[model samples]
Target: MTLIAERVRELTGARQPFVHATVVRAQAPTSAMPGDDAVILADGSIEGFVGGVCAETSVRAAALDTLRDGNTMLLRVLPDGAASFPDAPGAQVVVNPCLSGGAIEIFLRPMLPRPLIGVAGATTPIGAAVVTLAGFLDLEITEPMAYAGASAVVVAGLGRDDEQVIRAALDAGVPLISLVASRTRGAAVLDSLGLTAEERARVRPHAGIDIGARTHQEIALSVLAEIVRELRASSPEPVAAAPTRTAIDPICGMTVVIGEGTPHAVVDGVEHWFCCAGCRDRFVAAS
Candidate 1:
């Protein structure tokens, strides 16, 4: 038997998925029978039991071919039977025709990439946005002791002790890291850490949109809206474009983006815009 679990973890860290070939069923005469195991890495490398030179040779070659693209397959090798490089979901591994005589069955599974994110805060908005962004992306959200795949990480306490956390994140090669703070505070935190200007600039801070947020939940909404905005900026997936300007929904405190030329009336030094009559009614009633 092979240390399959460790290898799987390693392959996953490398963002490479491989095929899990197991000798589920076997027939007599062959030295290698059912219950044998082999890890077919994305690179087409095999670790574990080798059934036969002929079978191993062909499977290794086919596995590499599979790595170029993500395709799960199951192969059956017979004492003389051949191997087929089929697709996942229904593919089979047949490596039985080895000089050994027994037939071998191997299963192949493919792995794919995930979106990785490093968040600065996890309290409210940042946490929600990360969970949402991971809707399909590889998300790694990390906190003091929490680690979510390559989601978003919230730098709630961005200070000296936090240096390693940030540095480690960079070392881990996460795709994105967001800092939740005002520009001045963000600068101060970075400066205290003696980070290079370039490093400071690399952080996407300021949390999210500035829509008169006064509560933790509201702050989170603003940040999430900002993240969604950034995501929509380039995503091929369809999403409603946020209005360039948004007014706080006084009743619920939700930032309601108003389309251009929408009706608005100013009062108390702050402008209020509404997306619908109901919202407008609530805003007016709240006033």
Candidate 2:
């Protein structure tokens, strides 16, 4: 258990998504005892043992589901004949015939990485202020070149080399690019870069929420606020209803457009869709 805990900490530090499955309860004939734990990696590999093969299978399936949707779940694995036992509210129930009449309840918790913001061109006071404000806002910050993995990049170069910094950030494929500069200067920089209209549109000039900021700190706060808004907009919202034109893949949690050739399955009277045939096969096998 201590080793598993240490591994979990290591994985968390690496910003890798994983599921920690802990056996909260166990009935007689179960191979595992309460308090046993396992770490399920994003690739569906199990590093520790929570139960025997049957129970572990269910745990892996539930852990994958939790990792895909970023949801914590209480998974109850019972023998096929034990279906009469009432499952706890909000618990995911899996009936496995190979459980040998034993039952196990495991809690699956998904650990996802925090959103990262790259602060580039920090040589200027404005850039430094943005970094400081980002820290205060509990946002993780990285160098400009390291922004490739970041959720967004804020370029605060308010000098001659501002265009260079912005170009580097854009080439890194950073989703959101916020440039701190006057409208005239930003337009001049964009024109000089010879970027396409679409690429130019990606740059947010004056890079902040419209709070009429004047000082560096205020500007930094506004920029952080805008970043927060972008993050919120990118996050997956609850689906009020399953659209006929699109469906979420159960295996990988990817939103798939439903079309003539799209992969799909009907499991237990519920329609499940997949982005690819591989995901569809995996979902069928798991089910």
Candidate 3:
């Protein structure tokens, strides 16, 4: 159990998603006892045993489901030939095919990572934004090159190399890129970039929830709020026709549009989009 806990920490720190399964209850004839735990990797492999081979299959299926839904589930596995039992509230039932007339109940929980937000620029607004965002999200405070794995990137340089930073994020195919500048200044910078009209539309100006933010902290909060909205939206529209705005799905490594109805998973709180259900299933199975 101690080793399982340590592995969980290590995987989460590395921003990987995994399922933890624990046997909470067991009936006579079962090979597993209460308190037995195991870590299920993404490839449908188990690091520990909750029961014999039959019970393992049920547990792995439940773990994959929990990972996909980002929810905790109580799984009750009844032995072959046994009468099905009533499911508790929010618990799922699985009928094992093994000959052993034993029942096992396992609880599955998935640990996902928070989204990583990259704040570029050394300006006061950028610094304040990074500090303020620390309480709400995982932050990566660095230049555009450091945004390689960031879920979203925000430029708050207040005109200092804003174009360069924005270009870098765009070039890297970041899903969300916002500029913390006034409308006029943002438009001027965009114009200077010589981007086509369609490309310019992909860049959000005055990036924030419009609450009339004037101070640095307030602006930062507003920006963070907008980011939350983006993360939680059920169907977000894809950015306008920007050639550079293409995201690669981590699950299958396929390039996908960062748009509405795109299948994605939040691993260790970081968002990882998928190209299709098969890929998503594979990812969860392997995780």
What TM-score against the true fold does each predicted structure earn? 0.43, 0.73, 0.73
C-alpha RMSD by candidate, in order: 25.9, 8.8, 12.7
Query: lDDT of all the models against the reference?
Result: 0.53, 0.77, 0.70
Model 2: per-residue lDDT, tens digit, 1-287?
Answer: 49999999999788788899999988888889989998987666688889875466567667777776787999988887774345589988877654667788899998777678887777687889988887887778875577676778888867747677678777877778888888887777788889877778778876889898989889988988998998888775211222235566676554455545567899999988765677788888998
Indicate the residue-level lDDT of 131 in model 3.
54
What is the per-residue lDDT of model 1 for residues 99-166, given as tens digits with 9 covering 90 to 100? 34555556555554444445544445545554555454444344453343453444544343455656
Q: Rank the candidates by lDDT, best first.
A: 2, 3, 1
lDDT score for candidate 1 against the true structure: 0.53
RMSD of 3: 12.7
TM-score of predicted structure 1: 0.43
Give the C-alpha miss distance for residue 184 in model 2, angstroms. Answer: 2.9
Mind giving the per-residue lDDT tens digits that candidate 3 earns over 115-212?
66677764575556555665556553544467765667778777777888888877776667778888898788888898866667667877889998
lDDT comparing candidate 3 with the true structure: 0.70
